[model samples]
Target chain A: MDRQLVFELPNDLGCIEGAVEFVLLRCEFCEEVSRRLRFNFRVSLAEALANAMLYGNGGDPAKRVRVEVTVESSALQARITDQGSGFDPDRVPDPTAPEQLHRPCGRGIFLMRQLMDEVHYNDQGNAVTLVLRFQDTEALLREASA
Target chain B: MAFQVSREGDVLVVDVDGQLIVGNRQELKTRVLEELEKGEQKFLVDFSSTGYIDSSGLGVLVSLSKKIREQGGELRLSSLNEDLRTLFELTKLDSLFRIHDSREEGLQGF
Candidate 1:
Protein backbone atom coordinates (compact mmCIF):
# COMPACT_ATOMS: atom_id res chain seq x y z
CA MET A 1 0.00 0.00 0.00
CA ASP A 2 1.29 3.39 -0.94
CA ARG A 3 0.90 6.61 1.03
CA GLN A 4 -2.41 8.24 0.16
CA LEU A 5 -2.78 11.33 -2.00
CA VAL A 6 -4.77 13.96 -0.16
CA PHE A 7 -6.48 17.06 -1.52
CA GLU A 8 -8.54 19.66 0.33
CA LEU A 9 -10.97 21.90 -1.56
CA PRO A 10 -13.35 24.70 -0.61
CA ASN A 11 -17.03 23.86 -0.58
CA ASP A 12 -17.84 26.02 -3.57
CA LEU A 13 -18.24 25.71 -7.33
CA GLY A 14 -15.03 27.65 -7.89
CA CYS A 15 -13.02 24.69 -6.55
CA ILE A 16 -14.92 22.12 -8.58
CA GLU A 17 -12.40 22.23 -11.38
CA GLY A 18 -9.64 21.56 -8.88
CA ALA A 19 -11.55 18.57 -7.50
CA VAL A 20 -11.90 17.13 -10.99
CA GLU A 21 -8.20 17.56 -11.50
CA PHE A 22 -7.48 15.47 -8.42
CA VAL A 23 -10.01 12.88 -9.56
CA LEU A 24 -8.27 12.44 -12.90
CA LEU A 25 -4.95 12.18 -11.18
CA ARG A 26 -6.26 9.41 -8.94
CA CYS A 27 -7.74 7.66 -11.99
CA GLU A 28 -4.36 7.64 -13.64
CA PHE A 29 -2.86 6.20 -10.49
CA CYS A 30 -5.49 3.44 -10.41
CA GLU A 31 -4.83 2.68 -14.06
CA GLU A 32 -1.17 2.15 -13.34
CA VAL A 33 -2.02 -0.36 -10.61
CA SER A 34 -3.73 -2.53 -13.18
CA ARG A 35 -3.16 -1.60 -16.80
CA ARG A 36 -6.05 -3.86 -17.73
CA LEU A 37 -8.56 -2.11 -15.49
CA ARG A 38 -9.47 1.20 -17.07
CA PHE A 39 -12.72 1.17 -15.15
CA ASN A 40 -14.48 4.51 -15.65
CA PHE A 41 -12.83 5.53 -12.38
CA ARG A 42 -12.87 9.19 -13.24
CA VAL A 43 -16.67 9.24 -13.52
CA SER A 44 -17.12 7.52 -10.17
CA LEU A 45 -14.65 9.85 -8.55
CA ALA A 46 -16.54 12.84 -9.89
CA GLU A 47 -19.76 11.54 -8.39
CA ALA A 48 -18.12 11.18 -4.98
CA LEU A 49 -16.52 14.60 -5.17
CA ALA A 50 -19.81 16.20 -6.14
CA ASN A 51 -21.53 14.68 -3.12
CA ALA A 52 -18.86 16.08 -0.83
CA MET A 53 -19.20 19.49 -2.40
CA LEU A 54 -22.97 19.46 -2.09
CA TYR A 55 -24.50 17.51 0.84
CA GLY A 56 -21.38 16.87 2.89
CA ASN A 57 -20.88 20.58 3.50
CA GLY A 58 -24.50 21.25 4.33
CA GLY A 59 -24.60 24.37 2.14
CA ASP A 60 -21.87 25.98 4.20
CA PRO A 61 -19.73 27.68 1.60
CA ALA A 62 -17.16 28.57 4.22
CA LYS A 63 -16.20 24.95 4.82
CA ARG A 64 -13.86 22.69 2.86
CA VAL A 65 -13.94 19.12 1.55
CA ARG A 66 -11.03 16.74 1.72
CA VAL A 67 -10.44 13.76 -0.56
CA GLU A 68 -7.90 11.03 -0.03
CA VAL A 69 -7.06 8.31 -2.54
CA THR A 70 -5.01 5.26 -1.83
CA VAL A 71 -4.20 1.85 -3.24
CA GLU A 72 -4.40 -0.85 -0.61
CA SER A 73 -3.75 -4.47 -1.51
CA SER A 74 -5.87 -4.91 -4.64
CA ALA A 75 -8.42 -2.20 -3.94
CA LEU A 76 -8.40 1.48 -4.88
CA GLN A 77 -10.13 3.62 -2.28
CA ALA A 78 -11.17 7.25 -2.36
CA ARG A 79 -12.33 8.76 0.90
CA ILE A 80 -14.08 12.12 1.11
CA THR A 81 -14.49 14.05 4.34
CA ASP A 82 -16.69 17.10 4.79
CA GLN A 83 -16.40 19.86 7.32
CA GLY A 84 -20.04 19.79 8.44
CA SER A 85 -22.17 17.25 10.19
CA GLY A 86 -22.92 14.23 8.02
CA PHE A 87 -26.23 12.60 7.20
CA ASP A 88 -27.31 9.00 7.51
CA PRO A 89 -26.23 7.09 4.42
CA ASP A 90 -29.30 4.86 4.74
CA ARG A 91 -31.51 7.93 4.60
CA VAL A 92 -30.51 8.61 1.02
CA PRO A 93 -33.53 7.95 -1.12
CA ASP A 94 -33.38 4.94 -3.38
CA PRO A 95 -33.62 5.96 -7.04
CA THR A 96 -34.89 2.57 -8.22
CA ALA A 97 -38.47 2.92 -7.02
CA PRO A 98 -40.96 4.30 -9.55
CA GLU A 99 -42.30 6.74 -6.96
CA GLN A 100 -39.12 8.66 -6.29
CA LEU A 101 -37.43 9.17 -9.66
CA HIS A 102 -37.91 12.83 -10.47
CA ARG A 103 -36.24 14.73 -7.67
CA PRO A 104 -33.11 16.75 -8.42
CA CYS A 105 -31.11 15.59 -5.37
CA GLY A 106 -30.05 12.08 -4.13
CA ARG A 107 -28.92 10.82 -7.50
CA GLY A 108 -25.21 11.46 -7.02
CA ILE A 109 -24.97 9.14 -4.02
CA PHE A 110 -26.91 6.51 -5.93
CA LEU A 111 -24.54 6.68 -8.89
CA MET A 112 -21.50 6.42 -6.64
CA ARG A 113 -22.88 3.31 -4.97
CA GLN A 114 -23.54 1.72 -8.35
CA LEU A 115 -20.18 2.50 -9.92
CA MET A 116 -18.01 1.51 -6.99
CA ASP A 117 -17.58 -1.89 -5.41
CA GLU A 118 -18.08 -0.75 -1.83
CA VAL A 119 -19.38 2.45 -0.19
CA HIS A 120 -19.03 2.96 3.55
CA TYR A 121 -19.40 6.00 5.75
CA ASN A 122 -17.64 6.83 8.98
CA ASP A 123 -19.31 6.51 12.39
CA GLN A 124 -19.79 10.25 12.68
CA GLY A 125 -21.16 10.47 9.09
CA ASN A 126 -18.77 13.24 8.10
CA ALA A 127 -16.61 10.96 5.92
CA VAL A 128 -17.22 8.30 3.27
CA THR A 129 -14.85 5.87 1.65
CA LEU A 130 -15.52 4.35 -1.77
CA VAL A 131 -13.56 1.31 -2.77
CA LEU A 132 -13.12 -0.20 -6.21
CA ARG A 133 -11.55 -3.57 -6.64
CA PHE A 134 -10.48 -4.84 -10.02
CA GLN A 135 -12.06 -8.22 -10.55
CA ASP A 136 -9.33 -10.71 -11.15
CA THR A 137 -9.40 -13.75 -13.51
CA GLU A 138 -9.46 -11.52 -16.61
CA ALA A 139 -13.15 -10.74 -16.29
CA LEU A 140 -12.34 -7.07 -16.78
CA LEU A 141 -9.74 -7.53 -19.51
CA ARG A 142 -12.00 -6.32 -22.28
CA GLU A 143 -14.21 -3.92 -20.33
CA ALA A 144 -11.30 -2.39 -18.47
CA SER A 145 -9.38 -1.78 -21.64
CA ALA A 146 -12.44 -0.27 -23.22
CA MET B 1 -22.18 18.05 -21.94
CA ALA B 2 -22.82 18.85 -25.63
CA PHE B 3 -26.23 19.20 -27.25
CA GLN B 4 -27.33 18.97 -30.87
CA VAL B 5 -30.53 20.68 -31.97
CA SER B 6 -32.65 19.74 -34.97
CA ARG B 7 -36.23 20.12 -36.11
CA GLU B 8 -38.58 17.21 -36.73
CA GLY B 9 -41.54 18.86 -38.38
CA ASP B 10 -43.08 21.02 -35.60
CA VAL B 11 -41.18 19.19 -32.86
CA LEU B 12 -37.67 20.15 -31.95
CA VAL B 13 -35.21 17.36 -31.04
CA VAL B 14 -32.20 17.95 -28.86
CA ASP B 15 -29.53 15.24 -28.60
CA VAL B 16 -27.61 15.41 -25.33
CA ASP B 17 -24.28 13.73 -24.63
CA GLY B 18 -21.77 13.43 -21.77
CA GLN B 19 -22.33 13.20 -18.05
CA LEU B 20 -24.92 15.60 -16.57
CA ILE B 21 -23.78 16.88 -13.18
CA VAL B 22 -23.86 20.01 -11.05
CA GLY B 23 -21.01 21.57 -12.99
CA ASN B 24 -23.08 21.95 -16.16
CA ARG B 25 -26.47 22.57 -14.58
CA GLN B 26 -26.80 26.21 -15.61
CA GLU B 27 -25.53 25.60 -19.11
CA LEU B 28 -27.88 22.71 -19.73
CA LYS B 29 -30.85 24.61 -18.36
CA THR B 30 -30.07 27.66 -20.50
CA ARG B 31 -29.62 25.75 -23.73
CA VAL B 32 -32.72 23.58 -23.37
CA LEU B 33 -34.88 26.50 -22.20
CA GLU B 34 -33.60 28.66 -25.04
CA GLU B 35 -34.96 26.17 -27.54
CA LEU B 36 -38.26 25.84 -25.71
CA GLU B 37 -38.72 29.62 -25.51
CA LYS B 38 -38.23 29.88 -29.26
CA GLY B 39 -41.79 28.51 -29.68
CA GLU B 40 -40.59 24.97 -30.06
CA GLN B 41 -42.49 23.57 -27.09
CA LYS B 42 -43.09 20.16 -28.58
CA PHE B 43 -39.60 18.96 -27.86
CA LEU B 44 -37.83 15.65 -27.39
CA VAL B 45 -34.60 15.45 -25.45
CA ASP B 46 -32.75 12.45 -26.87
CA PHE B 47 -30.49 10.97 -24.22
CA SER B 48 -29.13 8.12 -26.29
CA SER B 49 -25.65 9.55 -26.04
CA THR B 50 -25.85 10.46 -22.35
CA GLY B 51 -23.76 8.11 -20.25
CA TYR B 52 -24.47 9.32 -16.72
CA ILE B 53 -26.44 11.94 -14.84
CA ASP B 54 -26.76 13.07 -11.23
CA SER B 55 -29.44 14.97 -9.29
CA SER B 56 -28.42 18.33 -10.61
CA GLY B 57 -28.88 16.92 -14.08
CA LEU B 58 -32.33 15.73 -13.09
CA GLY B 59 -33.07 19.26 -11.80
CA VAL B 60 -32.34 20.68 -15.22
CA LEU B 61 -34.84 18.30 -16.76
CA VAL B 62 -37.52 19.01 -14.15
CA SER B 63 -37.05 22.77 -14.34
CA LEU B 64 -37.09 22.73 -18.12
CA SER B 65 -40.31 20.77 -18.18
CA LYS B 66 -41.89 23.17 -15.71
CA LYS B 67 -40.72 26.19 -17.68
CA ILE B 68 -42.06 24.82 -20.94
CA ARG B 69 -45.38 23.88 -19.36
CA GLU B 70 -45.79 27.39 -18.01
CA GLN B 71 -45.74 28.57 -21.60
CA GLY B 72 -48.34 25.97 -22.65
CA GLY B 73 -45.67 23.79 -24.28
CA GLU B 74 -44.31 20.30 -23.47
CA LEU B 75 -40.96 18.58 -23.13
CA ARG B 76 -40.22 14.87 -23.40
CA LEU B 77 -37.24 12.57 -22.83
CA SER B 78 -36.25 9.55 -24.90
CA SER B 79 -33.78 6.67 -25.02
CA LEU B 80 -32.73 6.81 -21.37
CA ASN B 81 -30.22 4.16 -20.39
CA GLU B 82 -30.92 1.65 -17.64
CA ASP B 83 -28.90 3.63 -15.10
CA LEU B 84 -30.69 6.84 -15.94
CA ARG B 85 -34.05 5.10 -15.99
CA THR B 86 -33.33 3.71 -12.56
CA LEU B 87 -32.39 7.22 -11.47
CA PHE B 88 -35.64 8.65 -12.75
CA GLU B 89 -37.51 5.97 -10.88
CA LEU B 90 -35.66 6.54 -7.62
CA THR B 91 -36.31 10.26 -7.55
CA LYS B 92 -39.98 9.76 -8.50
CA LEU B 93 -39.29 12.16 -11.31
CA ASP B 94 -40.42 9.74 -13.98
CA SER B 95 -44.03 10.56 -13.25
CA LEU B 96 -43.40 14.23 -13.84
CA PHE B 97 -42.07 13.79 -17.38
CA ARG B 98 -43.11 11.69 -20.33
CA ILE B 99 -40.48 9.10 -21.19
CA HIS B 100 -40.17 6.99 -24.32
CA ASP B 101 -38.06 3.95 -24.99
CA SER B 102 -37.08 5.23 -28.38
CA ARG B 103 -36.70 8.55 -30.13
CA GLU B 104 -39.17 7.48 -32.82
CA GLU B 105 -41.79 6.79 -30.18
CA GLY B 106 -41.13 10.09 -28.46
CA LEU B 107 -41.57 11.96 -31.71
CA GLN B 108 -44.74 10.08 -32.59
CA GLY B 109 -46.21 10.86 -29.18
CA PHE B 110 -45.96 14.60 -29.83
Candidate 2:
Protein backbone atom coordinates (compact mmCIF):
# COMPACT_ATOMS: atom_id res chain seq x y z
CA MET A 1 0.00 0.00 0.00
CA ASP A 2 1.03 3.56 -0.73
CA ARG A 3 0.52 6.37 1.74
CA GLN A 4 0.58 10.12 1.11
CA LEU A 5 0.73 13.38 3.03
CA VAL A 6 0.25 16.99 1.97
CA PHE A 7 1.21 20.18 3.71
CA GLU A 8 0.60 23.85 2.95
CA LEU A 9 2.88 26.06 4.97
CA PRO A 10 3.55 29.74 5.18
CA ASN A 11 6.87 31.20 4.12
CA ASP A 12 7.75 32.05 7.70
CA LEU A 13 10.57 30.02 9.20
CA GLY A 14 8.47 29.51 12.32
CA CYS A 15 6.53 26.85 10.44
CA ILE A 16 9.60 24.77 9.66
CA GLU A 17 9.44 22.79 12.87
CA GLY A 18 5.84 21.80 12.31
CA ALA A 19 6.60 20.73 8.75
CA VAL A 20 9.47 18.51 9.89
CA GLU A 21 7.39 17.02 12.66
CA PHE A 22 4.65 16.09 10.26
CA VAL A 23 7.03 14.22 7.96
CA LEU A 24 8.64 12.39 10.85
CA LEU A 25 5.27 11.37 12.26
CA ARG A 26 4.30 9.97 8.90
CA CYS A 27 7.56 8.09 8.69
CA GLU A 28 6.64 6.31 11.90
CA PHE A 29 3.61 4.86 10.18
CA CYS A 30 5.75 3.56 7.35
CA GLU A 31 6.96 0.24 8.66
CA GLU A 32 8.99 -0.51 5.55
CA VAL A 33 11.37 2.39 6.05
CA SER A 34 14.43 1.58 8.08
CA ARG A 35 15.78 3.89 10.73
CA ARG A 36 18.78 4.82 8.62
CA LEU A 37 16.65 5.70 5.63
CA ARG A 38 14.24 7.68 7.81
CA PHE A 39 17.09 9.75 9.14
CA ASN A 40 18.34 10.49 5.64
CA PHE A 41 14.85 11.43 4.48
CA ARG A 42 14.33 13.74 7.41
CA VAL A 43 17.53 15.63 6.73
CA SER A 44 16.86 15.96 3.02
CA LEU A 45 13.29 17.07 3.59
CA ALA A 46 14.40 19.70 6.06
CA GLU A 47 16.75 21.21 3.54
CA ALA A 48 14.13 21.24 0.85
CA LEU A 49 11.66 22.88 3.20
CA ALA A 50 14.16 25.56 4.12
CA ASN A 51 14.84 26.31 0.50
CA ALA A 52 11.17 26.53 -0.27
CA MET A 53 10.53 28.86 2.60
CA LEU A 54 13.59 31.08 2.17
CA TYR A 55 14.52 31.14 -1.51
CA GLY A 56 11.49 29.86 -3.34
CA ASN A 57 9.07 32.04 -1.40
CA GLY A 58 11.60 34.79 -0.77
CA GLY A 59 10.73 34.55 2.93
CA ASP A 60 7.52 36.44 2.42
CA PRO A 61 5.01 35.65 5.13
CA ALA A 62 2.14 35.96 2.69
CA LYS A 63 3.42 33.35 0.32
CA ARG A 64 2.61 29.65 0.64
CA VAL A 65 4.82 26.61 0.32
CA ARG A 66 3.20 23.36 -0.68
CA VAL A 67 4.65 19.96 0.16
CA GLU A 68 3.46 16.54 -0.94
CA VAL A 69 4.97 13.28 0.24
CA THR A 70 4.31 9.70 -0.78
CA VAL A 71 5.54 6.58 0.91
CA GLU A 72 5.64 3.17 -0.74
CA SER A 73 7.07 -0.20 0.14
CA SER A 74 10.44 0.64 -1.38
CA ALA A 75 10.60 4.39 -1.89
CA LEU A 76 9.57 7.79 -0.59
CA GLN A 77 8.87 10.84 -2.75
CA ALA A 78 8.45 14.47 -1.80
CA ARG A 79 7.42 17.42 -3.93
CA ILE A 80 7.82 20.95 -2.58
CA THR A 81 6.49 24.02 -4.35
CA ASP A 82 6.45 27.73 -3.59
CA GLN A 83 4.58 30.79 -4.86
CA GLY A 84 7.38 33.16 -5.74
CA SER A 85 9.25 33.52 -8.96
CA GLY A 86 11.76 30.73 -9.48
CA PHE A 87 15.51 30.72 -10.03
CA ASP A 88 17.78 28.25 -11.69
CA PRO A 89 19.33 25.67 -9.42
CA ASP A 90 22.26 25.33 -11.82
CA ARG A 91 23.41 28.84 -11.02
CA VAL A 92 24.08 27.99 -7.38
CA PRO A 93 27.80 28.16 -6.79
CA ASP A 94 29.78 25.17 -5.67
CA PRO A 95 30.12 25.51 -1.91
CA THR A 96 33.21 23.29 -1.93
CA ALA A 97 35.21 25.57 -4.19
CA PRO A 98 38.31 26.95 -2.55
CA GLU A 99 37.04 30.48 -2.93
CA GLN A 100 33.50 29.58 -1.94
CA LEU A 101 34.14 27.24 0.98
CA HIS A 102 33.49 29.93 3.54
CA ARG A 103 30.42 31.32 1.80
CA PRO A 104 27.13 29.94 3.15
CA CYS A 105 24.77 30.71 0.27
CA GLY A 106 24.97 27.45 -1.68
CA ARG A 107 25.17 24.54 0.71
CA GLY A 108 21.44 23.84 0.88
CA ILE A 109 21.13 22.72 -2.71
CA PHE A 110 24.29 20.67 -2.45
CA LEU A 111 23.06 18.86 0.63
CA MET A 112 19.69 18.17 -0.99
CA ARG A 113 21.35 16.58 -4.01
CA GLN A 114 23.86 14.61 -1.95
CA LEU A 115 21.37 13.20 0.53
CA MET A 116 18.49 12.30 -1.77
CA ASP A 117 18.68 9.54 -4.37
CA GLU A 118 16.88 11.63 -6.99
CA VAL A 119 16.27 15.38 -7.20
CA HIS A 120 14.35 17.12 -9.98
CA TYR A 121 13.13 20.67 -10.44
CA ASN A 122 10.17 21.96 -12.36
CA ASP A 123 10.70 23.98 -15.53
CA GLN A 124 9.68 27.07 -13.62
CA GLY A 125 12.19 26.18 -10.86
CA ASN A 126 9.71 26.98 -8.11
CA ALA A 127 9.03 23.32 -7.34
CA VAL A 128 11.34 20.38 -6.64
CA THR A 129 10.81 16.68 -6.20
CA LEU A 130 13.05 14.46 -4.12
CA VAL A 131 12.98 10.67 -4.11
CA LEU A 132 14.69 8.10 -1.91
CA ARG A 133 14.65 4.37 -2.59
CA PHE A 134 15.48 1.54 -0.26
CA GLN A 135 16.10 -2.15 -0.81
CA ASP A 136 13.17 -4.45 -0.16
CA THR A 137 13.64 -5.99 3.28
CA GLU A 138 11.46 -8.94 2.38
CA ALA A 139 13.68 -9.72 -0.61
CA LEU A 140 16.76 -9.52 1.56
CA LEU A 141 15.29 -11.92 4.11
CA ARG A 142 14.22 -14.36 1.39
CA GLU A 143 17.66 -14.27 -0.16
CA ALA A 144 19.19 -14.96 3.23
CA SER A 145 16.96 -18.00 3.69
CA ALA A 146 17.70 -19.27 0.17
CA MET B 1 16.15 23.21 19.98
CA ALA B 2 17.94 24.20 23.20
CA PHE B 3 21.51 24.98 24.25
CA GLN B 4 23.33 24.55 27.54
CA VAL B 5 26.63 26.32 28.06
CA SER B 6 29.19 25.45 30.68
CA ARG B 7 32.75 26.55 31.18
CA GLU B 8 35.71 24.23 31.56
CA GLY B 9 38.42 26.70 32.51
CA ASP B 10 38.79 28.99 29.47
CA VAL B 11 36.90 26.68 27.16
CA LEU B 12 33.15 27.19 26.82
CA VAL B 13 31.36 23.95 26.08
CA VAL B 14 28.02 24.34 24.30
CA ASP B 15 25.70 21.39 24.53
CA VAL B 16 23.09 21.54 21.77
CA ASP B 17 20.08 19.24 21.71
CA GLY B 18 17.42 18.70 19.01
CA GLN B 19 17.45 19.51 15.30
CA LEU B 20 19.67 22.44 14.33
CA ILE B 21 17.64 23.69 11.44
CA VAL B 22 16.86 27.16 10.03
CA GLY B 23 14.39 28.49 12.59
CA ASN B 24 16.53 27.86 15.65
CA ARG B 25 19.98 28.37 14.17
CA GLN B 26 19.89 32.03 15.10
CA GLU B 27 19.56 31.11 18.75
CA LEU B 28 22.73 29.06 18.55
CA LYS B 29 24.52 31.91 16.81
CA THR B 30 23.34 34.45 19.37
CA ARG B 31 24.38 32.33 22.33
CA VAL B 32 27.83 31.66 20.90
CA LEU B 33 28.37 35.28 19.97
CA GLU B 34 27.30 36.43 23.41
CA GLU B 35 29.87 34.12 24.92
CA LEU B 36 32.53 35.33 22.54
CA GLU B 37 31.90 38.89 23.57
CA LYS B 38 32.65 37.93 27.16
CA GLY B 39 36.38 37.33 26.41
CA GLU B 40 36.08 33.59 25.96
CA GLN B 41 38.47 32.37 23.30
CA LYS B 42 38.17 28.60 23.19
CA PHE B 43 34.86 26.98 22.28
CA LEU B 44 33.56 23.47 21.80
CA VAL B 45 30.14 22.54 20.41
CA ASP B 46 29.04 19.16 21.72
CA PHE B 47 26.56 17.53 19.35
CA SER B 48 26.13 14.21 21.11
CA SER B 49 22.40 14.89 21.46
CA THR B 50 21.84 16.60 18.10
CA GLY B 51 19.78 14.45 15.79
CA TYR B 52 19.75 16.59 12.64
CA ILE B 53 21.14 19.75 11.02
CA ASP B 54 20.39 21.59 7.82
CA SER B 55 22.49 23.90 5.67
CA SER B 56 21.38 26.90 7.68
CA GLY B 57 22.70 25.24 10.82
CA LEU B 58 25.98 24.54 9.08
CA GLY B 59 26.10 28.17 7.95
CA VAL B 60 25.67 29.34 11.51
CA LEU B 61 28.61 27.18 12.54
CA VAL B 62 30.75 28.56 9.73
CA SER B 63 29.81 32.10 10.64
CA LEU B 64 30.66 31.40 14.27
CA SER B 65 33.98 29.88 13.23
CA LYS B 66 34.95 32.97 11.28
CA LYS B 67 33.80 35.24 14.06
CA ILE B 68 35.80 33.34 16.65
CA ARG B 69 38.92 33.41 14.47
CA GLU B 70 38.60 37.15 14.02
CA GLN B 71 38.73 37.46 17.80
CA GLY B 72 41.80 35.19 17.99
CA GLY B 73 39.66 32.34 19.37
CA GLU B 74 39.35 28.70 18.33
CA LEU B 75 36.25 26.59 17.84
CA ARG B 76 36.16 22.78 17.94
CA LEU B 77 33.31 20.30 17.52
CA SER B 78 32.74 16.96 19.21
CA SER B 79 30.36 13.99 19.32
CA LEU B 80 28.90 14.24 15.81
CA ASN B 81 27.02 11.08 14.96
CA GLU B 82 27.52 9.25 11.68
CA ASP B 83 25.00 11.33 9.70
CA LEU B 84 26.32 14.74 10.73
CA ARG B 85 29.87 13.53 10.13
CA THR B 86 28.90 12.46 6.64
CA LEU B 87 27.34 15.89 6.08
CA PHE B 88 30.61 17.54 7.00
CA GLU B 89 32.45 15.19 4.67
CA LEU B 90 30.06 15.77 1.77
CA THR B 91 30.40 19.53 2.11
CA LYS B 92 34.15 19.20 2.64
CA LEU B 93 33.73 21.16 5.85
CA ASP B 94 35.50 18.38 7.71
CA SER B 95 38.83 19.93 6.75
CA LEU B 96 37.94 23.42 7.90
CA PHE B 97 37.10 22.56 11.53
CA ARG B 98 38.85 20.41 14.08
CA ILE B 99 36.50 17.56 15.00
CA HIS B 100 36.97 15.43 18.08
CA ASP B 101 35.43 12.20 19.22
CA SER B 102 34.93 13.26 22.81
CA ARG B 103 34.47 16.47 24.76
CA GLU B 104 37.68 15.86 26.65
CA GLU B 105 39.62 15.51 23.41
CA GLY B 106 38.05 18.66 22.00
CA LEU B 107 38.87 20.66 25.12
CA GLN B 108 42.41 19.30 25.05
CA GLY B 109 42.99 20.80 21.59
CA PHE B 110 42.34 24.34 22.75
TM-score of each: 0.73, 0.91
- i-RMS for every candidate (Å) is 3.6, 1.1
- Each prediction's Cα lDDT score? 0.73, 0.85
Cα-based RMSD of the predictions, in order?
4.6, 2.7
Model 1 agreement with the true structure over A1-146: per-residue lDDT tens digits: 34577878888765665566555555564554343223234546666667777777866888888888886667777888888777888887676565555444556677667667788889888888888775541456656677
True contacts kept of each: 0.57, 0.62
Query: Model 2: per-residue lDDT, tens digit, A1-146?
Result: 23888869878887877777778776775655555455667777878888888888888888999999888767788999999789899988889998988976579888878877789999999999988876654465558779
Could you tell me which 10 consecutive residues in candidate 1 chain B have the lowest summed lDDT? B83-92
DockQ scores for all the models shown? 0.42, 0.74
Task: Return the number of clashes found in candidate 1.
Answer: 14
Residue A39 deviation, candidate 1, in Å?
A: 6.0
Provide the DockQ value for model 1: 0.42
